[model samples]
Target: MALFEQIRVRLPRGARADAALAGGVFVLVAFPEGKLLGHGGDPLPSRVVSWLLVIVVCGALLFRRRYPVAVGWFTVVGTGAYYVLSDVDGPLVLVPIVALYAIAAQGRMQAAIAMAAAMVIGVGAATLTTASDVTGTAVFMLTGWLVAVVALGSGRHGRLAYAEEEARLRATEERLRIARELHDVIGHNISMINVQSGAALHRLKKDPAQAEAALSAIKAGSRDTLQELRATLDVLRRVDEDAPRAPTPGLARVDTLVGSANLAGLAVRIERTGAERALPARVDLAAYRIVQESLTNVARHSGAGHVTIRLAYGDRELTVAVEDDGRMTARPARPGGGSGIAGMTERARALGGELAAGPRPEGGFVVRARLPYGITGERWSGAADDQGPAGG
Candidate 1:
């Protein structure tokens, strides 16, 4: 196998390579160094005719990849003609076998099988016509060789198809990841900027002092948006490994979210339960994004006065719930709403977690997510219903 790989690496590629290979094969069969294997009979034709037949049989291989099935049949019939015309039964037989493999490798299984069958039948008929002692064992061995060649070629085709499919799936997953990141980065900051700008416009004439403060907050929010946007784009444009990278958002930066929510006119409070411990990076990022998206939705839709964010760190999982004590405004969702709770749910589910968002019976809406540390083998042992505000 190592020698084969070395040869493959050194070989020329594409159509010219096939032409060179065909020429080499023709030379090996036509002018072998050793005596040629004969069919133990008197030659029935001229030596020139035999060489012409050899050329026709071996020359068909140059177009094997482009016209595999046609070349396969031509080589099969040509090999039989060569054996019948000349007493020589040499490496000329290898050309048809190579053509059969090419047919199978091009994903033409039925054509390869039919060709094999024809070749087997032709050989069996020739054994009957000639007085040679060709045994059943020889015929079976030839069939086995044909079967193995077809299997190898088909396996190569299957592996190539599987690699293509895997590449396509990875590309799709990357696209989805980029979409989610852009949505989270741009959606939240833009929501905050929109709210602050509205407040600034409303208070511009009645109270210029309050208007100035709102304008300042808007300016700051827009600047932060630009910085975060640049950071996100830098991550996407990662062409060099040694380049500086901003830290990914995680629960450690939840304070920044709270401060942003405070500026959005909602009093935000954070409560932690259970023993605080370090979380896996995926779980940490998922938890942060869930909370970030929930806060953005609350600021946009719910006219709430106070919001409570509860974080429960369990032995194997983490629960994050954002509840508000505000009026639940039944606003119709706009087309292509990025700040809705669906994106949060998708994030949680991607981490082997679940999220629930609904209007609480007591007051405003609530979003609860349960994220697991490891998403394999063991199932989550925590109580399933504890993801709500009442339990967590």
Candidate 2:
């Protein structure tokens, strides 16, 4: 049992292993088949040619994967030739059956069917009159075996195709998610710097100190943007690097985010409605991002004087809401469209949550996201809306 276990550990998986194991059985069975046919006036030949042909057919099957069609045809044609010349039963049936199965498993349906046809015709031409009923019985078995192999092979081929397609789809979705993260991280901060720089340039002569302040803000914003950008791009690295890494910002850093927006010239107030708790890394990151992106939209598009950032913890969900009383500016330039709303939606959906963003009927726009936490806040609390117009 130990020896068998050791051998089993080295076995290859799937169809290749199946072919190898079946090939061994066929080779061993060949000797008995030849001996059984060697009787009376129609004795099997003991010539060197007979053994060589059997070995050739068996050996050819080893390379079935690399050259499936060629190996299949060789085995089928070799079996026919051996029968015609030797007049003795051979393990030719197993050889062709195994070859056809390998061919179909390799997604060569046309070649497998063609090989089956050739085998039928070859058997008729070689054995019909000389062997009579034995020929019909062998052909009947071969016909049924070929049909089974084709069915099995076709199923295997389809499963592999589906698995490949699933892998490709997952990769595409990951790329889209990363793109959205980069856009939210870089786009908002860069846009803020652009606005600050323009303000500094306009106020340089009139208020040197104010211009200096704006420049200082731009410098600080640019630095933080680069740091977060580094963290985001770390995922794209193909080789190990020696650079230091930083922890990803989460709900813990919303204070710093609000401070940054305040510097970007948006007056803001934060509301924490429940006892704070640690969140799963992904949920935490998503929460921070939704807030950051909401404020970014306010800075770029909402002309409201004041904004509110609200974090409401719930028993099974955490809600992050950002609202402003500012007028909604025209849609900004977003690469994947819908002005960062779609990107935020994707993030929430990925985590089995949902997000909603639209203008409130009374006035200002709102962005609210609800993410599952399974621990936090009130049992049935929903995302908090602005009590009235935020900080009006």
Q: Against the unseen true structure, what C-alpha lDDT does each candidate score?
A: 0.76, 0.73
Q: Pick the candidate with the highest TM-score.
A: 1
Candidate 1 local lDDT, residue 347: 70
Question: In model 1, how large is the Cα lDDT of residue 257?
Answer: 83
lDDT of 1 at 242: 49
lDDT of 1 at 215: 79
Query: Model 2: how large is the Cα RMSD against the reference?
Result: 7.8
| For model 1, the run of ten residues with the poorest summed lDDT | 383-392
Please give the distance, in angstroms, between residue 233's alpha carbon in candidate 2 and its true position after superposition.
3.3
Name the lDDT value of residue 150 in candidate 2. 89
- What is the per-residue lDDT of model 2 for residues 1-392, given as tens digits with 9 covering 90 to 100? 99898788666766677567547856675767667556545633544556667778877877776788998999888877777676556566678787887788879999999998898777766565674545578778867877888889889988999999987976775566556666767777887787678778988999898789889989988887877666665655634554334455577777777777776667899898887888876678778778878888887777777898888988778898888998873336564464488777766766678899888787888898998863343221112210110100
Estimated TM-score per prediction?
0.85, 0.73
